[model samples]
Target chain A: MKKQWYDYLWILSLTYLILGFFNIMFAWLGLICFFVPLLISLIKGTKGYCNRYCGRGQLFGLLGGTFGLSRKKDIPKWMKSKWFRYGFLIFFFAMFFLMLWNTYLVFAGARDLKEVVTLLWTFKVPWHWAYHGTLIHPGAAQFAFGFYSVMLTSTVLGLITMVLFKPRSWCVYCPMGTMTQIICKIKDKK
Target chain B: MSSIRKKRKAFVEQADCVACGCCVKVCPLGAIRIISGIMAQVDMEKCVGCGKCAKECPASVIAVKEVTA
Candidate 1:
């Protein structure tokens, strides 16, 4: 198939990552990636965002399809099962809520903003170098750091699965995909 | 010459389709669409049976088959 304009969107994902690395404030931009899929799903009642417009999916396709970085193997059946997909979605929402809680803590002045990005909700990698003392409320920056960690962590997982399986294998289990799928179903019912 | 013509069309196995939308993305003709966010339904009239959707389908539920018309 000929490349469409959206095929080049992978660069946006890469650029977002690079920008976030240089200045943590750029992490707030990740909300575009986070929210756009849902809005599309709600309004369009389709997985069009996941299918055609996801920069992360495009990135994986470029790395694994064009560059041949993947094994091109089929993802395992268990990972594609409904139980696992829904379970992972729930886990993802839990992590998102935890990030929100941490941001709320910072917002409430109950805790200072942590200058670290937690990977996989476990390892807190010190990100002091990314912090340059933003004048914005520390809570906002705190949310940025937490949100960036979530985005980066998911990208890492996507890359790993892309290398192991098909280029777009991550689409099978992506939380946003699941959420959008649910939204599409609900919209279809209406 | 035989009156019957063999036309290739894409058929989706609804039972197995995960509705991942991978096929929907790769269909050059926009022949495949997700059915209520569930399974992929191919528009037989538009599907040229190029096999792109079948190849792109992660669930391997899409198949291009020859149909006699």
Candidate 2:
């Protein structure tokens, strides 16, 4: 295969530039796109976006593929222990609940976009560096809070997953991946 | 035609593969193919160690290594 510097750049640019911008504005839609590729990867057994598409993945893939830095050998048995997997599941659901509660707050008019943003920034959390929107406004704070909650939940889950499950565990248990796996199983059975 | 024997470098562990097709889809040289009865294979001659296949294989079954030219 022809490995070009441009391919790596394109993946980074699309992920950080296009996806990052859309995620800040159309949060739900952005989540869908972000998670869908992960789900597709899990069910299909491919890194999907991470291998060729994700900005983060591109960075890592380039380092590993070019410099031989991040290439994995064997996933240690302790890392893949049942306790870790189950613990991840618990954390995943808990985060999901938190996300739901945050969403409820938004719909119930208990919060707004600005409030969410401030809460996130106050917590020293940065969702996407480029499009932070307004920092001090109430609506922006609310938006940040809601946005950051999702980001935190996913980030924590992703970190644990990678450390424990071969650097792609989030792709397997992702709600999007869960849904797709279910669908794929059903299709296989049929 | 230059006659030089190319070293074999394609390593696939079927037992570990989840058959995600990321290798097949991302292979810039179209070297990897998934046979739907449920296994995947790599065409050694076509593979150039771009590492796209190995990078995308979620199961980590595909590994690319450098061999003598």
The lDDT values for all models are 0.86, 0.51
Clashing residue pairs for model 1: none
- Interface RMSD, every prediction, one decimal place: 2.1, 6.1
Residue ranges of candidate 2 with Cα displaced over 4 Å: A2-29, A32-56, A67-71, A78-94, A111-144, A148-179, B1-31, B34-59, B62-69
lDDT string for model 2 (A1-190, tens) is: 5665535653543453345334455443345445656565456644344334444334333444445443344455443344554465566566556656665676567865332332322354454543456544444434435654555446455555455444443443344433333344454556
Error of 2 at A186 (Å): 2.4
- Ten contiguous residues with the weakest lDDT in model 1 chain A: A43-52
Supply the global lDDT for candidate 1: 0.86
Predicted candidate 2, C-alpha RMSD? 7.6
